[model samples]
Target: MQASGYSFKELLGFDIAVLSELFSSYTTLDATRHNELMLYFEGVNKAWNHPGFTFLYHYQQYVELDAEPYSYTRFFEHYRRKYPKEKGSMKLQHIAGEEMFVDFAGKKLQIVDKHTGEVIAVEVFVAILPCSQYTYIQACRSQKREDMISCCTAALRFYGGSPKGIVSDNLKSAVNRSSRYEADINRSFKDFARHYNCVINPTRSYAPQLFNIKTIYNI
Candidate 1:
């Protein structure tokens, strides 16, 4: 075969550019679908144990989009290459000014009354901003509904602004009933969210939907 006129380096560069362009083209993939895929990955990772919990399964829900969906294998490959850490536990993305995570610290602190020699053990409220990992902590009398709400409000003030929403574990002070689909948030907590123009999102420690999904996958 006759030798090509172009240098090996030049040919390689052209090939890369063509592949990148084709990969991002509207028919193969578009900005909308790309964004949706990232969000989907994030959601599924957090609730991976959720029902029908697979990328292919979730892709089925986006069939109406104009762009053709990538093949299941390709989809998984692309996401894994882009977000390897997501496959591991204890990895999460926090958007600054978007969300605040609240919980009571496992430890307690002592408060000494100035007037008397009595000491009080107080619960510690902890709120974290996912993006910056900045924390706001306060000592509260207890994890009662009122105290929880007060601490949340104070955390917002300390942070200098309010987030779009707040996330908490299913605690009675924050959640009335924990459900897989939607946990019932406490009325007082709901009011606090309204007052700050934010939302309350509660997560259960044990997921029920995970069980259903595993059963379906097994069958």
Candidate 2:
């Protein structure tokens, strides 16, 4: 009904073509298109292409498809919304004597030589038990391979028992190569873990959120 007491069609100057949209039902895009987009996204994420690969480059492949491909903005939005840097946060269970997290503090400690009046800066290595929150700190000359291994070994000895695993960051001294899926441990560090009957599990290479020891132990 029209407010002027006349039929809406009589009052309006437009035809049914313009008003047809109001009564029309909007339809969803084809599911096949979304599935195909996800396929391309997964392939790119799996390192199928060069490190510098971009969405725009891959989107070109589907230019010939019948349906229009998603815009760059929409494509990126879906990728980021679906796939995160790391899987969403999960509850990690830390059994007693299960794992030890090790890292070097950013702040360095200094030692003074009385005779020469010289000061030496030392790296502070820290190890924490996830379950007990017990921490072991040691002063080391550097983050070199030998120093890291020595400090780790001493920390284990101090605990009086070796945990099932030792979690660490991708330090050159400890990790030969770091990746999101898998990380290779340095030969010496691998040997050290073997000797102590423990495993060396380095966190994701570039993702520091997974490597934060204090956050892991809630310290």
Candidate 3:
């Protein structure tokens, strides 16, 4: 019980500044796991001399004191209330006849054969003009080069004209290789676009924000 030598704040085993910093950093992180949060906290606050568990204990105490009803779940609810995350708008402005977005729907549609009582699943191809919100849909047997080209031709015919550029997902039929900086367009698809006097613009791999027509058009 020799508390005379140690400072009162040191004896408490927690620093309010450190705890607040940890909480603020935790709010920005995508991971909700305590261990990951602790790792990130350690990496950021290297000057702080404390064990990981000790930091976690102080965090728990801070949460309980700051949040009402005193539980980890309640602490998150309280945190969210204090600092709400900002949502981004997905709406994009487009020029008329500038771009046409095309993609295959995630779900397949079923087609029943008239002669035989059998149902066949078909891929749904969707094309949309961002400016006019005009849409064209076609069901194809597969997303092969020929089918994809046919769909694009049909969509253009339905619209009565072709856009300056055709925005497409990185499907194998359209894109030979997908890349962040530049994608390799398939030869057949390239010829199809040239014939129609439109450029093929493939979206970046794994990035939906570039060509999220479904969400943008409310389709």
* TM-score top scorer: 3
List residue ranges in candidate 1 displaced over 4 A: 1-90, 207-219
lDDT of 2 by residue, 1-219 (tens): 343465666647656775454444566867788888877777757753343344565556555552768876787788887786665577778899989998887557799989999999998898989787788999999999999999998998899999999999888899888899889788999999999999999988677443453323322
TM-score of each: 0.53, 0.55, 0.58
Give residue 5's error in model 2 in angstroms: 59
lDDT per residue as tens, model 3, 71-180: 54544454445446588666578999999999887657789999997999999898988887788989999999899999999999999998999999888899999999
Lowest lDDT block of 10, candidate 3: 47-56
Better of 1 and 3 by TM-score: 3
lDDT of 3 at 38: 47
Better of 2 and 3 by lDDT: 2
lDDT (Cα atoms) of all candidates against the true structure? 0.72, 0.78, 0.73
lDDT order of candidates, top first: 2, 3, 1
Best by lDDT: 2
